[model samples]
Target: MAEKLLEVRDLVTAFDTEQGRLRAVDGVTFEVEEGKTLGIVGESGCGKSVTALSIMQLLPRPMGHIDGGSILFKARDLVVASADVMHDVRGDEIGMIFQEPMTALNPVQRIGRQVSEVFLLHKEMDKTEAWASSIDVLEKVGIPSPEIRMSEYPHQLSGGMRQRVMIGMALACKPDLLIADEPTTALDVTVQAQILKLIADLQKEMGMSVILITHDLGVIAETCDEVVVMYAGRVVERAPVLELFGNPLHAYTRGLLQSIPRLDRERKTRLPTIEGNVPSLEEMPEGCRFSTRAPEAHDEAAIRERPPFEEAAPGHWVEACRFCYAG
Candidate 1:
């Protein structure tokens, strides 16, 4: 088994808004082992991105806070660390490719200079050396004319190229773990595949663990070793990729699997979709968050109290009312 690279225990992250205190990541727990990829999947507003930010200790504060829990990166607690300490760990030890590359990159700075900053700041490299190394890394990520691209600003590069630059920046220091929050969101289908392939190749080469956060199950099936299904703010199910695909136990997981478009289908109509928007953080259903849309959902009784997530198989987990089993 690969050594555990990152472990998040009972992570409870919340946001304080004018409305009230909303728990975005309520008691979420998972682990990522070295050289393995753990994909976190859920619809929008399901706390996937917030969880990623919490792990990085990059939550926008005053508004957001880690109320309870620990983010253990190689056994070190990042949740409770000081700002200065976290700065040292952010890029050097734990790298992250934000969901949107355009916003993540500085508009005013040249793309090459932005990528080189990681080496210059953390790796103790001089500007000249950092610039050279940045171009090399960019080329490694499949960017064309890395030396020329380095001097160009963010607005100058295409979306795909900008994303490649983002990947280059994130992987520059060869961090042990990489948190990719919807890394291919803005790219077209062909570009998306290329980016995903690049990431897969890089992960294999570096033996680094990756947490890929996305709403697309197809991407998860292709790139992930294990999968964690989240609904509302909690993890609804988790299992190995093949097991999750072959024998999904949770109703929510089943819905997600069914929602994937299959080319082999007899009728090529519109794809199946999970009904209802994901519940708001302030008004998450009490029991199973997925119960609202699950076809087998029994009653609001399940929503009266939180259901225990039980292991239905070796690594498969699900939370639902016992009443749903009565039939």
Candidate 2:
């Protein structure tokens, strides 16, 4: 087996809401092997992005915090790493492609300066050298007219171009792991395809592990080696990408798979849905968080206690609900 690059075990992240401390990411766990991609898939608000933010230790502080658990990266745990240690880790050892580049990029800064800052901060390059290297990275990411684009401000560029710039910044330091949070969000279909391909190509070229957090199963199918299905802040099922697509085990996984639109004449019906919404962080139910929405959740144990994840098949895991579910 390839060495583990990132392992998140029993991660618990919470938000200090007015009502109380609400767990946004509840005991989510997954791992990324070196030079591989792990996809985190779920509906919006299912803790997909929260899980990524927790790994990066980029949670909105005071309001948001990692409450417990370990985030091991390259044999070192990040949950306990000092601020200075994490400062070195963020861009040098781990890079992140945040969603919505328009908001994430600085409107006031010229594109070149923003991208070059990574080199100046992490690589100890001088301003002149950093500018030259940033332009090279911009070109590497397929930005047309890198020199001209470097002078442009965020507001002056197209959305796709801005996104490519974001990619340039994220990869400038050649971080060992990249966390992409909804990298294809809000783009045209053509642009989305391009972005996904670009990310895949780069990961392969750099031999970097990746954590792709998205609700799009299609994206996950195309990009990830392993798949993690999350519901209400927990990993309900996890397996190799092919195993997940071929035989999803958890009820939520089945519902998500069923909801994907298809062209078959036999699929001419309203898409399947899980019926109930994911519970709010402030008001989660007792027992299995998914029992509120799972069709197979009928036994008292599903409501009285949470299901443990156990191997249902080789290299495939599912919440051990079948043992307790009455129906």
Candidate 3:
């Protein structure tokens, strides 16, 4: 069996709003295996990013917190870990690439300072050593003219270059796991492909596990070994990539797959879509959250009580509601 690097069990992340305490990640459970990629797929407001932030302990202070659950990294529970422990773990043991590089990067800092900070903080390297290491990382991530780019600010580089810098920072310490939360968002198709390929190449070179959170199934199909399908703060289904794509059991998963535009289809044919927006936290359903939007008729009991997430096949788990479970 593969070694488990990270195990998140019953993760419940919440925010205290005027409306009251609202759970954004409700009972989310998944694991990342050593040197493998796990993709978390869901629409906006489905708690994908919140789950990532919860793991990193980077949630908005005062309002957001992990209300319940255990995030275990290398057998260590992060939920109860001290601030100092988490600080050590953030970039040294686990690194993260945020969705947007423009917003994530320090606007005023030069590229060298930002990238070298990772080594300075985690590796305890001096200014000269850290600067040299940062340039090496920038070069490794395919940043052209790294020596010159190091002196430039975030606004000086192109979108793809900025993203490459972000990748360099994340991988500076060669962490055991890398959490990329839509690392290619807002980039052109060509740049998106390049960024994904760069990440795959680096993962292979570094031998690190990755938790890739994105709504793009295509990216998941290309890069992920296992897949977790989330809807309304809960994981609706999970399976190996081939298993999930070939034999999707949950209604929500099926809907998402069907919505992907097919090249084999007739020209101008309308692409299918999952109808209805994700329900607001205040209006979230008490039971199987996807049941409200599920097209087929379902048992009323599903609405009254949450259905058990059960394995329908080897390595394939689904929210086992009568109507929701296709198998």
Candidate 4:
């Protein structure tokens, strides 16, 4: 087997609210190999972002907690690492691009200073060297007027440009792993394509592994080498990207695939939508969480117990319901 860059095992993250302790990331397990791209896909509130945050150990303390599981980077246990140690590991070995570039970037600071911070903090480089490297990285990420743009604050750049800056910062240290959470959200189709292409190209050029979190199956198809499908905080299916697109076993995966708008589909036909909203963490169903939204799961008999993640075919795993199995 290829050397694993990062391995997440039975990760369970939770948030304490007045209502109860809500499990946001429940038992998500996967690995990203060196120089490979892994996509985490799910609708909103499915714990995709939380899973990434948990791996980074960036959860807000008062409300959030890493309740269980192991996050191993290079065989070093990150779950028990100190904040200072985590700080050292974050930008130096593991870089992350958050979902919202506007919110993730500091509005008050110039882009250069923000991007250079990684170099200064992790590489222990002088301010001048860090700044120069910042411009170089920005230029490499295809940002125009790199020198001038570096001096501009976050508000001065377009959505795509800001995203490029975010990617630049994440790649600045040449980290082994890059965790991108919905990197292309809200961008036009053209810009989205550009950003995804940039990531794919960079991953190859830099020899970096990536975990891309998004709801769009199209994005996964375009970029990821492997795919993990999540529902109600659990991994319902996982496989090679081509295997997933070619033959998805889980009903939820099928629903997601059908929801993607395709030019090949008959014109003027409305796209299929998975019925029911993702269940709130506080009100997760008794058995398999996805049973509630599953097209053939309207009856109670369809949801007796949570299905085990079983291999339906070589390298393709999914949680299967007996009723759906028969169908």
Candidate 5:
């Protein structure tokens, strides 16, 4: 068994707005083992990205804060880490690949300078060495003609090449844990496959753990070892990839799996979907957050109180009314 690289316990993160303090991640708990990939799968507004940002302590300051709970990275509490400590940890220990490379990359800066900053700031490398290392990493991430590309700006590169540059920058310092927030989003199918494959190859080569946040079950299936299903800022199910796919116990999980467009299956008049919508944080439903959309949420227990995360089989966990999805 691999060592646990990161452990988040009952994490509650919230954003304070004029309306109220809205909890974006409520009581979410999970762990990532060293050299393994843990996928956080959920739809938009499900707090998947927020959870990653909280771990990095990059929440937008006073507006966003960790209300309660602990984020233990390698057994060190990150929630309370000072600014200097967090500054050191961000790129050197826990690198992040943000969703959009165009926005994430500096438009005015040259690609080589941006990539070299990681080595210059954390690795104690001088200008010449850092610049050399930048080109080397670009090549390592499969960028064509790395030396020539180094002098170009973000707009000069195609979407895929820019993404590769982002990956290169993230991995430049060789962090222990990599958090990729929708890394393959907005890319073409072929490019998506290439980016996913690159990440998998890099993780294996570096022997680092990964926290992959995405809504695409297909991507999760291809790269993840374990998956955490989130709905309304809460974890609804957690299990190994195969078990979750083969024997999905939560109604929400089943809905997600069913909604996948399968080429082998007969086309339906209308695609299956979970009716209604994810509740807003302020007006979240009582009992189970998903009970509003659950087909079998008629029982009193499901409506009266929140359900506990119970282990259904080995590592498979389901948190819903006992009778929900029971049939």
Candidate 6:
């Protein structure tokens, strides 16, 4: 069996709003194997990003917090880890690429300084050494004229180049794990493919595990080894990439798969869409969350109470609600 690099067990992350404490990541659980990629797929407001931020312990302070469960990274529980330990772990052991490079990058700082800061802080490198290391990382990410690019500001670089710089910074210390949350967002299709390929190639070269958070099933199919399908703050299905695509068990999963436009389908046929909106957190169902949005006809009573998440097959798990679990 492959070694597990990160194990998140029953993670419940909540945000304090005026209405009440709302759980954004309710009972989220999964594991990332060493040197393997895990994709967390869900629609907006399904708590995918919250789960990732919870693992990183980057939730907004005084508002968002991990209420329950453990984040075991390399066999150490991060839920109770001290600030200093987490600081050391952030860049040295786990690096993250934010969703948008434009917002993530420091606009005021030169590219070289921003990238080199990782080495300066984590590797204890001097100015000279950090600068050189940053150049090498930028070059490794396929950024041409790295030395010149390093001197330019964030605004001077193109979107693809900025993203490449972000990748360079995230991988600067060669961390054992990477968390890329929508790394290719807002980019053109061509640029998206390039960025995805770049990330895959880097993962192979660095032998690092990755947690990819995205709503794009196509990206998940192309890159992920294992997949977790989340809906309304809970995981509805999880399986090997091929297994999930070939045999989805949850109604929500099936609906999502059906909505994907396929070339095999008639060109003018209308694409299927899941009816109804995801319920607001304040109004979330006490039982199976996706029950409100499930397109399939089901016994309403079956979803009146929460169902147990059970292993339906080897390495395959689903929220086995009678209304949702097709199997």
Task: List the candidate 4 regions with Cα displacement exceeding 4 Å.
Answer: 298-304
Cα deviation in Å at residue 104, candidate 4?
1.3
Clashing pairs in 2: none
Name the weakest run of 10 consecutive residues (lDDT summed) in model 2.
318-327
* Candidate that beats the other on lDDT, 2 or 5, i.e. the better one: 5
Model 5 alpha-carbon drift over 4 Å, by segment: 297-301, 323-327
Candidate 2 RMSD to the correct structure: 1.6
Candidate 3 has what TM-score? 0.98
Q: lDDT of each model, Cα atoms only? A: 0.86, 0.86, 0.92, 0.88, 0.90, 0.92
| Model 6 local distance difference test score | 0.92
The list of candidate 3 runs beyond 4 A from truth reads: none
Please list the Cα RMSD from the true structure of every candidate, rounded to 1 decimal place. Answer: 1.6, 1.6, 1.0, 1.5, 1.4, 1.1
lDDT of 1 by residue, 1-327 (tens): 678888898899999987799899888888898899999998888899999999888899789999998988877899888888898888988899999888899999998879888999898788899988998999999987888888889999999988888888889999998999999988899999999999999999998899999989999999999999988889877888999899777777777888887879967578788888887777777676776677775566686877776777776766645643221
| TM-score for each of the candidates | 0.96, 0.96, 0.98, 0.96, 0.96, 0.98
The superposed Cα distance between candidate 2 and the true structure at residue 223, in angstroms, equals 1.5
* Candidates 4 and 5 compared by lDDT, better number: 5
Candidate 6: residue 117 Cα off by (Å): 0.8
Span of ten consecutive residues with least summed lDDT in model 4:
318-327
- Lowest lDDT sum, 10 consecutive residues, model 1, at 318-327
- Separate clash counts for every candidate: 0, 0, 0, 0, 0, 0
Residue-level lDDT tens digits of model 4 in 184-293: 98788999999889988998898999999998888899889999999889998899999999988888888899988888779687888988799887778757777767
| The best candidate in terms of lDDT | 3
